[model samples]
Target: MKLFKLNKTNLNEVEQIPFKLEKDIQSLVEVNVESVFNLKFIQSELSVDKYRIDTLCFDEENNSFVIIEYKKGKSYSVIDQGYTYLQLLLNNKSDFLLVLSQYFNKVLRMEDVDWSQSRIIFVSPSFNSYQKDSVNFKGLPFELWEIKRYSNDTVVLNEHRSNSKESIETLNPTSNSTISQVSKEVKVVDEDFHLSKTNQPLVDKWNELKEEISNLDDVEITPKNDYISLMLNGKTLCYLIFRKNSISLEMNRGNVKPDGSRSKNYFDLDDPKKISKEGSWEWKSGTKGTIYKIPINKTTDLEYLMFLIKQKYKNLSN
Candidate 1:
């Protein structure tokens, strides 16, 4: 079958990619080898012993197999193919995993696999009532998407289905970072302004942070002894781990180092305007390191902080 290649260059401006669902499936299979099973388009004889399948997919992570059959538009017979593939794949676990590992470049240990828990993904533009109603669409890993040709591109997109897939959710959680600023050498607020006799610099920075954070519904700030902590949606976004003589405005302390410091990680504490009164600070015993950490709630930047918290400091993902 001849494919409709999109001549346009930019993928961002275009709402859809000019590629068929099969093409998308190919690219997805090529790149995401580690995450997904291998999808191969095969043509096997419909012999009594050897039942052929449209496409075979094996998942190493779940010790599972999936049969993906593509029907042009909406076909009711896709379910029949799915069930047929299921019966055949159940008898050939070793063959599927062996081919899967070779395709993905990883060794799969499938000594005790339960093929009954396998899935079927029928790819078609639409589904009929009998196909939809009779089959346990929710129970099986079947996904339906509408293929559209818009502005010169034929794109296959996955429809958002909110199912309680505990296993899948635990494997990949939603990350909350925007900017990919994980460079350890990024400028930290190294310069210090001592909080003596109404420091305007300190106050200016503090109010700015307070105003910015207060605007977001997730954030709430209140004084805790000499320090202030920022909470986002009941989760502690950051806190001013204030020590009188050695002040360190630690943002995402869950990822703070052995001794509290971002190691010049070019990220501020949760709020730049929330500059605390730099009463007294010291780097070494008497070095006087008056520093305030200004942190932004950038989803991606808190990787280190998240790491710190997960390792020993706190629990965030849970």
Candidate 2:
């Protein structure tokens, strides 16, 4: 990657600085772990059984543990190591949470954790073609991030996202028994899961909404176990959960004020009353307040739904 700086009318290329050691990369990341990935730093060089975890973190939003390994060389299989670490977490939940509680001085509960969304992230200067291809499966629970530093003191971190909607369970059916067992426990949910639970009409409406949002700038749809989140620049803009008769929308602009009362005028829309049928205008839970339920039973509801979606898209871009 080439970076340029404007010197009057001419542009000068910035020199690329290669990281000297893996430890240097780890230290840089560990110091600013929360800001980079919104993860709470657990411990570095954590020796779990025979393996040593490079950097362990806790994802507060997803309520899961994220294992991040920094690599300077290319000689590891992402699938094998990723699954192995995931299996280790699954087998020993208490041990992981205990260490976290001790470090942060707070009691971390076992039941509050979401094991299915547990994943491993590999950060390196670059990834080989094989390593990138290994995580091509949509639901592998592994993320590859390439990090680089320049002489200008600017660092770039790029995540290699998969375009495939196919799950690893279907693609890797003939894999080893360990992977198969782990797959059964910690599987990634797709759009099909929501479709199976809801009716055809609601599913059709969701598809329509998804397609419309896909046309917007830098918008990507990621299907989770409970909901489908619309992400812009890796941050969640809107979260949609498929209910029995309607699709619930939750806008994640930021934290809402912690008030016990659920108000009708919660959302700052031009006409909040118009989209009331879409979902409840009242605030719901703590951080995820006001889950607006948009019913797909009528064509008019969809027309009104566009306003809610566009508002969220606009807020995210800003």
Best by lDDT: 2
lDDT of 1 by residue, 79-161 (tens): 45554565556556677766666766788777544454466666544566656543432333344444444454444444323
What is candidate 2's lDDT per residue for 1-318, written digit by digit as tens?
788889999999999899999998999999998888779988999988888999999887778889999999999888888889999988888989899789778997888788887888899999999999888987678889999999889998888988887667775586566688788778666777777887777778777877777777888787776788888877777777887776667663333455544333244545465554333233454533444444455354655677777776675566
Error of 1 at 291 (Å): 27
Q: What does candidate 1 score in Cα RMSD to the true structure?
A: 18.4
TM-score of 1: 0.37
For each candidate in turn, the TM-score is 0.37, 0.82
Model 2 residue 112 CA deviation (Å) reads 2.4
Q: Quote the positional error of residue 33 for candidate 2 in Å.
A: 2.6
Candidate 2 CA-lDDT value: 0.78
Q: What is the lDDT of residue 258 in candidate 2?
A: 55
Model 2 poorest ten-residue lDDT run? 276-285
